[model samples]
Target: MLKIRIIPTILFNNFKLVKGISFDSWRTVGSIMQAVKIYNLREVDELIVMDISATNNKSKVDLDLVNEIANETFMPLTVGGGIKSIEDVSNLLEAGADKVSINTSTFNNDFFVKEASKMFGRQCIVASVDYKIIDKEIVIFSNSGKVSQKVKFIDHIKKMEALGAGEIILTSINLDGTMKGYDIETLSKASANVEIPIIASGGAGKLKDFTDAVKNTDVSALAAASIYHFTNTTPRDVKIYLNSEKIPVRIN
Candidate 1:
């Protein structure tokens, strides 16, 4: 059996590492290189670095900086934000990213996902989705959660899978950065509808939050930013806790 992966997502505003609540009011936590070295020491399973300011600023994904960080870490590195075409995907991969995530462009023109998957295997493509609840219904938000897809969340996941996404990263806007826990109901529903892997992201506050998410749903992996950035918990400790709770995890 495959052990569950504990992924730490790193957000970048330019080159500075930052954390925010519900995707707003970002405060710089430290430099990206420093954070990368720390996670490397902790032996994190994977790292996701998203350039939060890229899309809104109409700039490209910071490929140079990503290339620099990818050289520093040994874990699987995935980078996202401002990816518009197949060339961008090639550039990120060439920069040493194991996989590339596309959000706004995928929602706006889903063919990008299909074409990227076709060009460079589905395993290299990740569909990153950010969403919020409105009127007791889940709504898909894109462009870093600033715009709405106006579609049901599960439907979007199915569409992404059909378009050949290797995995889906589902983030809950209301629960993001709140450190409450994973959004189990939404995550469960989304995971059940897709055959591909679902990586649970956002709202992981404590060790129980991770256990609670895996127990409630079959997430392939759980990801967080604030808790890992602001707290003293290490990946090794989390694995120990999960193992003690009888959950399958990879001990580092």
Candidate 2:
């Protein structure tokens, strides 16, 4: 079995790190730089820094800020938000991002994924999908979960894969920051549909939550913001617990 990754997600808004529940009611966490520096020491597998407001603000992720954060982040860095054009991807990569996570822009121009993949290779692209459950059905949302795409969840992920996205960051808008646990049924189904790596995000509350997803789903990585920020649980602690459960993880 391939080693599972424990990733820390940084939700950045107005130059500060924040965490929110159900993709709303965001609250400031701390200095973005400070958080990155701390994660540098935490033995995390990779780091995802998202400019949560950039899409709504009609602006691209601040390149200068990403350059600054990337300088401090020692692990593989994935940056997302308001990414539209090919140049945006190029600028981000040149600024130090190891991978670029594209969300809202893809809704308007999914061909952008194919173009980026062809230019930079699929491995450089991470297609981010945010969805919410409505009337007992999974519905896709974009623009930071404000607008509903009204598309089928499984079809959307399969589309991303077909478009050459190297991986998918599946985030449940309903479960984000709730710390209730991952939407396991949805994740398991999504995993069974895709061949590439899937980074399961949202609703990670405890150690067992991490273990459960690994044991039950084919997800390659587990990502959370609230558990690491609100609780004392660190990525290392989660890895130790997963290791105790006989799950494969990289320990250093």
TM-score of each: 0.98, 0.98
- Top candidate when judged by lDDT against the true structure: 2
Q: Over the stretch 1-252, how does candidate 2's per-residue lDDT look in tens digits?
A: 578999999999999899999989999989999989899977579999999998999988888998998888778999999999999999999999999999988889959999999999999999999998888999999999999996688989999999999999999999998899999999999999999999999999999999999989999999999999999999999999999999999888
For each candidate in the order shown, give its overall lDDT on alpha carbons. 0.90, 0.93
Clashing pairs in 1: none
Question: Cα lDDT of model 1 overall?
Answer: 0.90
- What TM-score should be assigned to candidate 2? 0.98
Q: Tens digits of per-residue lDDT for model 1 on 18-125?
A: 999999989999999898988888788899989998988888877788888888889899999899999999999998899998999986785999999999999999
Given candidate 1, what's the lDDT at residue 135?
88
Off by over 4 Å in 1: none
